[model samples]
Target: MYSTWPNLDTKTIHQQVLKWINERNNGLQSQN
Candidate 1:
């Protein structure tokens, strides 16, 4: 059903946020 769509989008966003955080945590310059 349509319920799965939100879950997919949230997961993608979560991963991006994690990556951005990791870059910051590592003190690496990023354009995110």
Candidate 2:
């Protein structure tokens, strides 16, 4: 995810982290 997302700016990194975290959360919820 982060590998493909361009994180050259501070805001982009923050958004990417949130995006990655959300995906991880969704995956965990599906397992339950």
Candidate 3:
């Protein structure tokens, strides 16, 4: 899936993944 983004460098991709993980964690916390 990451491969689909043509111009994203490693640092950008890492940041995006971190942001996504944080969002998912927040969602899970809210549900609890």
lDDT (tens digit, per residue) of candidate 2 on 1-32: 45665646667888878999999999999999
Q: Residue by residue across 1-32, what tens digits does model 3's lDDT show?
A: 76888799778999989999999999999999
TM-score of 1: 0.58
**How do the residues 1-32 of candidate 1 rate in per-residue lDDT, one tens digit apiece?**
43656756767777878999997977755543
Q: Worst lDDT window (10 residues) for model 3?
A: 1-10
Error of 3 at 32 (Å): 0.4
Error of 3 at 12 (Å): 0.1
Cα displacement (Å) at residue 13, model 1:
0.1
Cα shift from native, residue 6, model 2 (Å): 10
C-alpha TM-score for every candidate: 0.58, 0.75, 0.80
For each candidate in turn, give its C-alpha RMSD to the true structure in angstroms.
Answer: 6.5, 4.2, 1.4
In Å, residue 2's CA in model 2 sits off its true spot by: 13
Ranked by lDDT, top first: 3, 2, 1
lDDT of 1: 0.72
